[model samples]
Target: MLVTTPHQDHSATDLPRTGPATEPAAELALLRGDFEVHLTVGAEAADALAAWAEEHGVKFVHILLARGSAASQPMLTLRASGSYTEVLAETRRTARRLAADGFTVLRAKVESVPWAEGVPASDADAARFGAARYFEHHVKLLVPEGAATDGLAELAVRHAAHLSRNARRVRPDGVREQFVTQRCRLVGSETAAARLDALLADLTAAGHQVASAEREFVALDSDETLDAGWIDEVAAVAKVAAVSTAA
Candidate 1:
């Protein structure tokens, strides 16, 4: 089951106070309690590392590598799967193992961006793809490069929720299954309503076949479900709620 606990912001305590001039050879840090591990690797090596991590029961959380016109060896990021708390525990175990495997832990900054908009689609395939909900949480992470937007994976992780959906239908291999869904909290009566309104506006503008909408939710085109990239676009409009106006 997905672990549910308040994500403690221990980045200051969890991360190093300073960094070197250049990025470290390899490092891992927990962002908002979720383990975000970064390491440099070549393009081919990156693919291999992903497979290896998965084979060892490590779920891919998010990844960010160097960007350029030409493809070359790049850094590999390993993340723990599940809620912030769940991932945190797994990360601790995985971090030690990764260190033994020649990886070092570095200070990373994590920021939890509030998600104010989310739209569910009506298509059955979208449901299967788990495009039913959107989630947001407080973020915390270490920025080695000082807040430069480097890669899509980094941006995606920093500003989005870990959407969970069912994999392709398959016969059970005598293993029990648990499906998890991620959700975001709306701060107040008016703010929640405003956010939902913005969500519906974006979906309709993006040519999504909107099915319905409400004060805090909406239904959109799910048949040709847009990936997380599209959802990111929708969420981009959601601004952080003002502290004084929060419920």
Candidate 2:
């Protein structure tokens, strides 16, 4: 996906591939389209009447029926899709209908449906979940008020480049499917946060923020998030490549 470079000053031209290596023509095809809409809608019956009331987004909705008429099962799950702007407009319209019908609704939950999982609006969408859930995060890094503020520009440059490597796009929660990852090459959020903290140790209380809420479409079998262990994969590949070269 083509992302707007967050800042003009950062140039990360040699960023590594997140997706597989592709022919130039294949890459062009990937870029020549708008991202179709993908997000999940969650709402529940406030009472028996609302529970059975014809659900909004029903065509796209995943009905999580309350165990019995008055019972609570898990929660509502509706997956909506279409052109980006139109899907959102339609979802908001559906949400309004649900609220009016008396269902308790959480804000729409955004999900990243990767290729292995299948495309949005598939007949099998109801049966699929992604390899892992993704987060659309906003990070705040400021110069320490009392510390040397001279490095803020440099740090900002690095941060912007880092974000580009990890995410599909740099956009807001509702406009959908945005992702955030650290550029420091450190994987854990806590460790990454500490690195930012130590670097900014003074002045504007420089640190990071996890300002987004994440949701998954289905029960994830693993807790994997960051690429903390990527080195092993790279090392294993390099070892075989080296052997092949020598042979």
Evaluated at residue 73, the lDDT of candidate 2 is 23
lDDT of 1 by residue, 43-77 (tens): 44545555655666544333321322222323333
The residue-by-residue lDDT of candidate 2 on 120-183, one tens digit each, is 2232332232322221223333222344323433343333212211112234433322122223
Assess candidate 2 and give its TM-score to the true structure: 0.25
Estimated TM-score per prediction? 0.30, 0.25
Query: Which residue pairs in model 2 clash with each other?
Result: 144-202, 144-203, 144-204, 145-203, 145-204, 146-203
Cα deviation of 140, candidate 2, in Å = 36
**Candidate 1: 10-residue stretch with minimal lDDT:** 217-226
Candidate 2 Cα errors over 4 Å, as ranges: 1-50, 53-74, 116-247
Candidate 1: residue 57 Cα off by (Å): 2.5
